[model samples]
Structures are given as C-alpha cells and as structure tokens.
Target: MRKPLQHIWALPVLAAGLAVPATAPAQSIDVTLVNGHPSIFLWVKHLTETFIPAVNTALEGTDYAINWSEAYGGSLAAVGGELEAVEVGLAEVAAIPTVFMPTQLPLQNVSYNTPFGPSDPRLVMESVAMLHDTVPGVEESWHEYDAEYLGGGFALDNYVLMTNFPVTSIEDLEGRRIAAPGPAVNWLEGTGAVGVSGNLTTYYNDIQTGVFDGVIVFPTAAAPARLHEVAPYVTITDFGAQYAGTLVANRTWFADQPEAVQNALRDAAAAYTEAYLVEQTDRVAAAMATIASDDDHLHVLAPEERTRWASALPDIAGVWAENANGMGLPGSEVLTAYIDALKAAGADLGRDWSQR
Candidate 1:
C-alpha cells in the first residue's frame, strides 16, 4: 500500500514536469501600415515585399509576433494625408511624403528646396539619414506631429524636363509653361518658364490639354506614366535625386511597443532603405533605355547649359532656411549640415546651398 501511494505521487510530479516544458504561445501584436499612394509605387511595393517580410523574419523565435494590416492607395488617406493619419492613430506607421507636408515638416524638405546636387539616390538617402540621426531639429520636426522618423527613401534617377518641343538652352524654357510638383516650382525660377503646380497623376492630361507645355519629373515615373507619348522630348536637367520621405511610426504606439518589437521595426526600415536604393539604381538605366527606345526625341542637356540653369535660380535655399527659422526650427543649421555632408560624400553639387 505504501509503494502504491508513492507511485501515484510520482506520476503526478512527472505530469507537472512535462507541462513546464510546454512554452506559452507568442504574443500577437497588431500593426497597421498606411500610405497615401498605391502599392504599385516602388516605395509602397517594398513595404509589402521587403520591409514587412524583414520584420516578420526578425521577430521569428521571439516572444512577440506582428499581425500586419496594410492601407494604401487612398484607402485610408489621400496623397498628403499620411502624416495626419499616423498622428491621430489612424495607423501605426506610414510613409509621409515631406514635399506634400511642407508646412508641417519644413526641415525634412531640405532636399526639395535645394536641388541640382548629387544624382545618385544612394548618396542622397545617406546624407538625409545622417541629418535625421545628427540634427535634433530634423527629428524634432517629426516629433511635433507625434511621430518618429525611421529612415529616408528616394525616387529613382535625376529629375528632367519632358516637353512637347526641344530645349537647347535656358532661353528655350523662357515664356513657356512648365508643370512642376509642389515646391519643385522653384526650379523654374529665373528660367522664364511659367511654373504650374502639378503632379504625376495629372501630368499627362495637363500637358495634353495644353495646361502646361512640359513637366519636371524623374525617368522611372515618367516612363511608366507614358508622358513621352505627349511630351516626347526629354531633357536630362540633372536636377538631382531627392529624399522625398521616410518610414515613420506613431509616437504613442511606438513607445508602448516592446524593445524587441521596436528594434525589429527600425531594422526593417534600414533594410527597406537599402533594398529601395538597389532597385531604384537599377531601374534608372532600364527606364531611360525604355524611354529612349520608345521616344525618338531625347536630349542630354549640355554641361554648360545645365550649369547655367542651376546658377540662374535665385537663393531659394536661403528663403527656405529663413522661413524655417521663423517657425523656431533649426533650418539654417540643418541646411548647413546637409550640404556639408553631401560635399564630404563627394557629391557633385551644382551650387552650395548653405554657402548662399
């Protein structure tokens, strides 16, 4: 009877020991990503292809897993509504295009205000990332909107002019109407080209309807839009690649996340940046080739002509810095740091925006 009782106790103890090795299921965290534009765009595409997958992989074997919800193509917000969407907690993270939110993110628009710099997307992203990491004002600009900047992503290739007619010199653009997106209207300054505010979605129809004679755009985008069909002449103005926006997360939600989860989001952002640059760089040449093959009229503006176009522009950078300073943001400091970093990186700048 004593042996039987001991065996019964040992059986219960063995059962308890077996249960201890059964680990609890990982916690599931819900994260929603939003973008104003459709996922067809390269940056948005990477969110699904590169960034999200990277995050999932990083979180593997961890105690937490993310269940992602994606809102893109104006499903959650329009072209310029991403910043506000994230701020109000409509989404956990977003790709906020700084060009569209000039009033709210003036400091992040450093690349847009100062153009004709490096054409390489990789170099442009590096310079902007360095500023975000080093410049307190740059990061603070995002904080003001209740979000945190992760990393920068740039569109492919340098900006160019797509026109119905040929442009041999700066004088050619004089008195002609040109459609430029948002602040890019500044690029047409002093060129005599009448700058009309426009975007990619409307570029083709606008030019076809005679609303604007030409458009300032990059190859990767222009080719897909088939702008060459209406505006056959493409002048490589070398306006330089631009750091359009970044991956950002809502401040409140990001703060509440576990440390491991936070690291995964950031690490994934870094990977997204690298993957985007690689694709953007490769796509440039291919896009240019497709355009050249499709359109008979293609011109690479003379080096001297390019220089004149850049030099004739007014001190827009100075005006931008002044405006930012008035808003109590460190515009001048960031501008100086950005130009210096680009120079140190061996960027072939057409103008030293900071010096001016």
Candidate 2:
C-alpha cells in the first residue's frame, strides 16, 4: 500500500536506468603483426610470449584493447618481404630483419657492418638500442621506408662456422663455399672462403644438397635447425653476436593511434628485447652443452687462429662505413658510437673497426 502511493514518478527513473547500456566494453583495435620467419626464431617467439602479452597487460582496465593478428613464417610475407609489406600497409606492424633489407635500412645494419666487437648479446642489444635513441639517421632510415621504429633491438648469439669438414686454420676455408646471411657475407672477405648469400631457412637444404660447403651461423639457431646433422663440424669463429632486426609499425597507422597505444607498442618492444636476450643467453649455453656432449661435432677454433682469421679479413667495416657516408648517412658517427659503446662496456674487441 505504501509503495503504490505516489510511486508513478519513480517508474521513469527506473526505466531510464534499465535503458542505459552497461558501460560498453572497451573498443578493440585490430593490429596485424607480420614477420617473415616462423615463430621458432627467438625474436618471433617472444612476440607472443613477451611483447604482445606486455602490451595486453599495459592496456588492461583501459578503454582500448588490441586484437592481434599474427602473420608469420611466409604466411603474410616471405623473408625479406616484411619491409615492403609494412610500407604498403599490408600489416600494421612487423618484426623487420634489417639485415635482409640492407638497401632500405642501411643504418640498422651498423652492428653487422662492425663485427668482432662484442659477443655478449646484452651489450650488443643495449648499444643498438642506444644508437636508435641517440642517432637521428637510424630513426630517419626507418621513416624513409614509411615505418616508425619500435624498440625491439635484437642480437643473436656469437656466430660460428658449421662445416662439413674441419677448419683448423684459415687455409682450411680456402675455396670453401660458406653460406652467410645477407651482409654477413662481408665477414668472409679475404678469408679465402666464398660467402654465399643465404639464410637460416635455406641453409640446411642448401648444405645438404651441396649448395654451400658450410654456413656462418649462430648456435641457438643452428641447434634448432639441426644444421649439425649435415654440417657436423662446428668451429667457434667468434665472429661475435650482432644486432640484426627490430620492430616497426606502419607510419600512418602509428600516427592514427592514440598516444597510449603508441606508448604501449614501444614499451612492449623494450620488453621483447629483454625477453629475447634472456632466452638467447640461456639457449646458447644449453645449445653449447648439447653440442659439447657430442665431442665429434663441436670444435673451438684456437684463439690465435681466430685472431688470424679476423686479421686476414679486409677492412669491411671501414668500407661499409665509407660507403654509407658516401650516401649521406652518418655511418661514421654510428660506427664510432657503436664501437665506443662496446669498448665502454669492456668488450674484448678482436679488431678496431672504428680506428680504420
């Protein structure tokens, strides 16, 4: 009886409350992440494990979310095709292996051009990250390709030579067709080894079919690829780990995003770098152990021979820097800053690339 008295006015308020939508769920932004290589690669693996997860975590409780569509391993683009893919907006983001796109992203290959400086993955990563932050040319190079450089600066473990036969001296590499990825072919100059341009995906089949005599590759990758099965003789060349690639987003797509989304992408990239380094460190030791257990497969080149091999090489770094500078890029500054960073980190450099 009490409720029935003068309760007709309250019905409208109750109806209004019912009509209001329960705060609509956050709007989801769809982002496609493309990488030419399969997720088996450490860098690609962490895209799911660390980077994407970190971004999702950072955006939690926010009014924005990302629906990630991952296209990797030749699904969206073939190896070396990521640059063009992102440039044309085929994908929103990409893990671009700059080594593969040397012509377009020359500055990102500074570490590749300046090898034998440091074998520590962490140091290489930090130096490259620093270069990206401090060097305008580095960032500008990416912009030229219509992409914004995200923060994933990756370094592989130290490179080694996996050959069908043993390599005890520089003479052993004479006339040998050794496979090297992209610009790393430069590392073979004057070593008497013929460096064929090849990548991890094709090396195993190439070596097996006699396309090349051996491959200049790192342990973590070689182990999983099972290159040891075909190229059983492993020589620890100490060519040093290298910063090979980074995350990039389509410039237009990135510009259209909210500031929070932009920050989340960058923060996630940093997390990717750290996660990759940790995995690479642990995996390198484990891979070495796995190889060491098979004594017949693993051999460390004598330190003297390593130095001799390094000395036999031409001034590849100098030539590389000079060539880049000729093209109006700050190649020397990048080289100097990189070597300086390595030296500051107490790296036992095999050659003074900056001095040349």
Candidate 3:
C-alpha cells in the first residue's frame, strides 16, 4: 500500500496548531491528491515535496492520520479536468488550474483578464486571496463546484516567449503561430500572431511537429520542459506574474474529515503557498539562465516594443468584466480591487485595466 510522503518540507511547528484530543479514537483517513500536470511541473513538485510533508507533520500525535495516494501527470485526470475530478469525488484533493475553468471560475481569472500589471508571483496570489475575502462570488464559485480552496496556489513568474524564430520586436511575431495555455491565448491579440490553445504537456512536440512556432510560458516550466532545445529563441516578454492555479479539497470530503485533520490540511496548504512561491521565485532566475546560453540565445524585447504590443491589444479586460457582469458576477468590482491592490504594492503597471 502507498504511504504518506516523508519529506524535508515538513514543519514541526505544524503540530502545535492541530488539536490532538487524548480521548479520541485513532483513525487513518485515505486521501488521494491529484494534479493533472506531473511532478515535473514546479507546482506539482511543491505539492509533493512541501505540501504533503507539512500535512504529515501537522497530524503528528493527532487522533487522525492521513494515508496519501497521488495521481499526477494525467494518471487520473488531465489538464483542465481537475475541477470535475474533485466535484465527482474521484479525488479528495487537487491542484486546479483556474485558467482552464474560465466558464466556471470567471472571477478567478482577474489577473488573466488584465495582463502586464504585476510581475511578482507572491503579490499576484496574495491579491487573489484578498479577493476571495472581499469579493462576494469568488469562493462561492468554488463551493458551487463542490471544492473548498486551500491557499496553496501556483503563480507563474513573468511569461516569456520561446520561438523557433528570433524576435526583436512585436512585429516580428506577425503571422507566426504561437501556443498559449487557456486564457493566455487572449494575450496574443493584435500581435498579428495566431494563438493556439495548448498546455505544457504538448508544447515541445507540438512545436517540433510544426503545430506552432513558439510558446508563451514561464521560465520555471520552460526550463523543465527543455523548450530551448526545440525552440531556441527566448524573449523576455514581461507579461508579468499570474495566478494560474491553486490547491483545493473536495468540499464533502474536506468537511467530513476530523477537525484536527482539517486544521492540519488548511495550515499545510498555507505553508504550501509560501514554500511554492519562495521556491518558484528563486527558480525563475536559474531557469532563465539554464534556458539561455550561446546556443539558445535570450533576447529582451525593447521596452517601447513591449509597450507597443500592450497598447495594440483589444480591451480584453473590459470585455471579460462585461461578460462576468452578464453572468451576474461583480466583474468590475473584482477587476478594480485587483488592479488597485497591485498599484498599492508599487507595481509599475504597464496598463491600468480599470481605466481603459
């Protein structure tokens, strides 16, 4: 039988917060954690290396124990299928990519709707958590799907462009076919490049097979994929850090767990958020360095060139907000709050979506 992971990310302090009752009966609860992307993905790695160990540490000496089973790399669910997996009770906990659930989680796509705003992954996710508190319909959407969100979120570092061809300006991308995941596809507007919907799993093969010429992705993931070998041109796009996904527990399962177990999971989830971001932030530079070398040359698109690209894009933010409003969500409110918070954090936004 598979056992709970024993890992270095364990925190002894996590035990203090768990309520261990002396009279409680010992029980081992089975939990299966699912991530569509495999452990090679930075977020999934942290969920395994940091989140799971902390969860074990939190439950030490408690009346409840968790027997963890993992299903990753689409063993149980594919990218964009995580929400349904938890809702159907196929898994107890999961790392859900919100970008793939735009129709169901429109409010969670605030950062995707307003791009080029913030570059700090930590700030982006913290702002999203704040939205969960201040925004009325945010968490409610998750509840509607029978999932309870834990704070362990996967936020992307600034997105860069990897292409088979060199790009010194936005115009160079004209007529090129580029792959982007989910809402990121919308970012290609007015760049004259065709945006193909895709995820990390298929990027390398797809690019090599002529499915696309390039991909817009972050360094942490790009390095692991070894995208440089296939598409050697790396351009720093500065599209900014984005909150792509988060950890969630099946609502019914999470509620049914013992309070002590629940507390531990929740605390560990928060720890997952911190640990994931810390590692991700650190990995970004190293990943970039690894992906860029003499053979795989790195280019920084001129500041004015990026600004030109940003300006040419349509009002995706307004359109997204209006669509949300059509669905009775507070689109304007969420957008305003997110942008305002980023500004307050000293992010030199390239464009204020709330304005235009």
Question: How do the predictions measure up, each by TM-score?
Answer: 0.92, 0.94, 0.91
Q: What stretches of model 3 exceed 4 Å from their correct place?
A: 1-25
lDDT of each: 0.86, 0.86, 0.88
lDDT of 1 by residue, 180-276 (tens): 8778899999999999887777888989999999999988888778888888888888899887888999998999999998999999999998888
TM-score of 3: 0.91
Winner on TM-score (2 vs 3) = 2
**lDDT rank, highest first?**
3, 2, 1
| Pairs with steric clashes in candidate 1 | none
The 10-residue segment with the lowest total lDDT in model 3: 4-13
> Where in model 1 is the C-alpha error above 4 Å?
1-21
Question: Over all chains combined, what TM-score does candidate 1 have?
Answer: 0.92
Worst 10 residues of 1 by lDDT: 289-298
